[model samples]
Target chain A: MKHTHAEENYLKAIYMLSEKQESLVSTTAMADFLHTSAASITDMIQKLHNKGLVIYRKYQGVTLTDRGKESAIKILRKYLLWEVFLVDKLKFGWSEIHEIAEQLEHIDCDTLIDRLDHFLGNPYCSPHGIVIPNADGKIIDKPRWLLTDLSEGASGIVSAIKDDSVAFLQYLGKRNIYLGAKITVIEKIQFDGSTDITIDNQYKINISRKITDNILITL
Target chain B: MKHTHAEENYLKAIYMLSEKQESLVSTTAMADFLHTSAASITDMIQKLHNKGLVIYRKYQGVTLTDRGKESAIKILRKYLLWEVFLVDKLKFGWSEIHEIAEQLEHIDCDTLIDRLDHFLGNPYCSPHGIVIPNADGKIIDKPRWLLTDLSEGASGIVSAIKDDSVAFLQYLGKRNIYLGAKITVIEKIQFDGSTDITIDNQYKINISRKITDNILITL
Candidate 1:
């Protein structure tokens, strides 16, 4: 079923929020994620529920039906593909592509997106190392560990990022950290959850617990 | 100023309609072009006028202000650039790219567009051979003539297409006619205004006057 831009956005927001929390996605959380009002979220949730895209319970929140999940996956597929195109082809910084890809993701054309995926050589991950859902809405949930999970001697390759905020990405840039960088935990601070890591076995830098929590790595 | 998708679409429609006629664009013509009601067109035109994007004179119609024209040209630039990307890179047919480009043109990012322009190697025209305006919104309107104006035995290279309708473009595709094809007028029938032409000194086909009038050629 064809969906409006607003509807698609709500689906994506609900999908993302669901990933972080196992419980039903709260309307307030959705409102915060979308930077909208609680009342607006409730109204849209009703619209989505009527469309059979979501199941909403009074005072509880909502959950996507199977159809809604599929629709949201399609949006993610488009978003990741365009992000790949922007970073891989157009030479945009990984941090710079999310907002642009947000707009591109709403472009309603499945064939165009399939063609773009092929043009970009069918990337499996976005520039931020996030896994891209396949054309059939299948995504492989690869094993990943947050940087904070490692001990002082543990080491791994940066595989994905949990946070894709521009400020976070810019900070990563300033720290010379990037996807695929081989990192070794040099020191684990006992006072705080901060960690000192050597990047690619080269430059050593200290990162806070917040940074470590967001940076996913594969041993 | 940032423009909504509907507002930008109206600006583009006005710009395109203005190109066909020298006078102000009528609400009826805009409604026809946009497939909306005359009342809706008037409502939108009034909104545009309030933004100083257009000068609306009741009954006579509307013309874009300088700022409005610039905004329209920027939309055109994005549209044409995406068309080039779709056809040249994504391998989409010339006819198929317009609708996709229509969605892509509304992507709002000056830096992304500039990067895309650079990535596409600074194309001069779109897949359908329409001149693309530069970043400054300056377009070089090259001289072109309708194929119907070409006399018998006159020949030139096809430079642009006035009608980008899917049916017309598909017909051109079926007949192996394309942008940059060298077409020679073999015969022009005065009775019905249909013309016989040879394409690339190889394939010969007869096309209707409607086709001839829509194909633009340069001597």
Candidate 2:
């Protein structure tokens, strides 16, 4: 089904909110996330509901229909592919690519995007470690847990990052922490939730609770 | 001044028409070029005039103001850069890239496009041989004339392509003619306007006037 860019954005926002919250998304919450008013969100939600893209209840909030989920996933696939292109090929910093990819994502040429996917070597994740949906919209999501959740001496490879702010990624860069880096928590300071860790089993570093919470990994 | 995508398309159509005809762009001419009605052409022309983007007269037709030409060129610059990316990196055939690029040209990020230009090695021409404009809207346009216009024994390098239809580009590809290939007209059969040519002063080939007229070259 053809959707205006605005409609697609709203659907994508709802899909993301539902996934993150694991529940129906309220119009007020969507308005805050998208920086619009509750009135505008309600109006667009009604339009999407009429189009069968959403299941909305008067007081219970809304969730995506199957078709709506598919559409949002497609947009996400395009967005992630474009982000990869910007960072991997175009040499853009990981911290500076989202807004540019937002515009490129709306271009909606399946052949162009698929060809771009092949061109970029069909990566499984974006630079941010967010999983990229494949051609069939399947994402083989690996189980990941926060760094702080691991017991002392437990080791895992950094498989994903949950924060997007530039400062956080740059701090990780400075500390030599990134996706695929093998890490072991040497000791845990439970008083403030900081941990001493060895990366690649080569160098030991210490990070605070904020960093541990944002870094996710797989055993 | 910000122009809508529709307005940019109209200005670009006018700029192209005036360049091709070397005269004012009539409302009828614009309507035909844009696949719209003359009434709709006049409506847009009025809006453009109010914004000082175009000089439109009731019966004398319309022409782009300097501002309008600049706007059109910016769109063209983005359009052609995307064409280069598709062919150079994505392995898309020149014949298959124009429509996809038409959608990408509307992505308005100057820094992104400039970085792309640098990333692509700052190409001088698109796959079709159209010059790419620089940051300040400067284009170092080479003087080019039709292949037919050159006399026998004249040598020139193919600098530009005059037609964008898929069939035409594919035909050129099949014959091994491309931007930067050098050729010399060895003989001209003026009766049918067919010519015998040697490409790169090597492989001899014969082409009709139709092909010669569409291949622009510089001595």
**Considering every candidate listed, which one attains the maximal lDDT?**
1
lDDT of 2 by residue, B74-115 (tens): 888888889888876776776778778888888877689999
lDDT score, residue B94, model 2?
67
Native-referenced DockQ of model 2: 0.53
Q: For candidate 2 chain B, which ten residues in a row score worst on lDDT?
A: B87-96
Compute DockQ for each candidate against the true complex.
0.65, 0.53
Task: State the lDDT of candidate 1 residue by residue for B1-219, as single tens digits.
Answer: 899999999999999999998999999999999999999999989999998999999899999999999999999999999987886677676667778899999999989999999887776677677799999999987777899999999999777777767777678878988766789999998899899999999999999999998988876
True contacts kept of each: 0.91, 0.70
Candidate 1 chain A: 10-residue stretch with minimal lDDT: A87-96
Q: What is the TM-score of chain A in candidate 2?
A: 0.69
Best by TM-score: 2
lDDT of 2 at A54: 93
Task: Score each candidate by Cα lDDT.
Answer: 0.88, 0.85
By DockQ thresholds, what CAPRI class is model 2?
A: medium
Alpha carbon lDDT at B101, candidate 2: 88
Return the TM-score for each candidate structure: 0.71, 0.73
Kindly report the docking quality category of candidate 1. Answer: medium
